[model samples]
Target: MPHITPCLWFDDQAEEAAQFYVSIFEDARIGAVSHYAEAGQDIHGKPPGSVMTVSFELAGQPFLALNGGPAFRFNQAVSFQVVCESQQEIDTYWEKLSAGGDDAAQQCGWLKDRFGLSWQVVPAELSDLLGGPEPARAQRVMAALLLMKKLDLDALRQAHAGG
Candidate 1:
């Protein structure tokens, strides 16, 4: 299968965003960086030799960050999910990614990062807890989840147990 890479459009912050992401993910690294040339100044309007694109990898997944100007912005409709094995992992990621982020956008383990990117920090067993065989228990878990910003594994388990 052909390798697919998600390209992120930024308003002249592609390099900055790529660096920030590389700092956050342990298995991340910045790859090649391309600069704008005078040839496309009429269309792109970016200064010659300015950063135009940055290639990066996060957790082994390849990505591209483009300095596409302010024609677009990130929204909650598209989000990156981080499945953590423990509460500590979730806490670490949540704290790091949510720093300088929009507090008003935080809900149910979902947050808008400083760069306006959406992220979901969730437990690894979230699917099992929210889609268990018992519909009532799953509903309870869902209720507990909706009431929380950062998910509590213990509370979810308790809700599933009908506590």
Candidate 2:
């Protein structure tokens, strides 16, 4: 079967965004880089030899970042969800991805990174809590989550425990 890789569109920061993502995730590495050629310069308006695309892997998942100019921008409609095993992991990802980001955009584990990419730094326990047998607890968890920016696992747990 052919692999399906996610391609991210960036105004002109494909290489920079790829490197930033690689630095934040474990087991990430930069792969092949393609530069824009003179042939498409007339249409694309990008300088020849400039970075056109950057192939990279983040935690073993392949991704492509394209320097597609400022024609498109990222919005909240689509986001990358990062499942975290612990609060510390969530904190690390939140801090790294949200650095220089819009503070107002953060809520219920969702954050917009500096590059305008949206990310959900979610805790693994959230599913179990939200999908447990008791729907009341799930409601409580949701209520607690809605009140904060970055999710607080302890608060969710407390809400689940009927605190």
Per-residue lDDT over 70-147 for candidate 2, one digit per residue giving the tens place of the 0 to 100 score: 999999999999999888998999999999998989998999999999999999989888987899999998999999
What RMSD value applies to candidate 2? 0.7
Q: Per-residue lDDT for 1-163 in model 1, tens only? A: 9999999999999999999989999999999999999997999999999999999999999999999999999999899999999998999999989999999999999999999999999999989988856899999999999999877888988998899
Q: List the residue pairs that clash in candidate 2.
A: none
State each model's CA lDDT, in order: 0.94, 0.94
TM-score of each: 0.97, 0.98
Query: Model 2: runs farther than 4 Å from truth?
Result: none
How many residue pairs clash per model?
A: 0, 0
TM-score of 1: 0.97
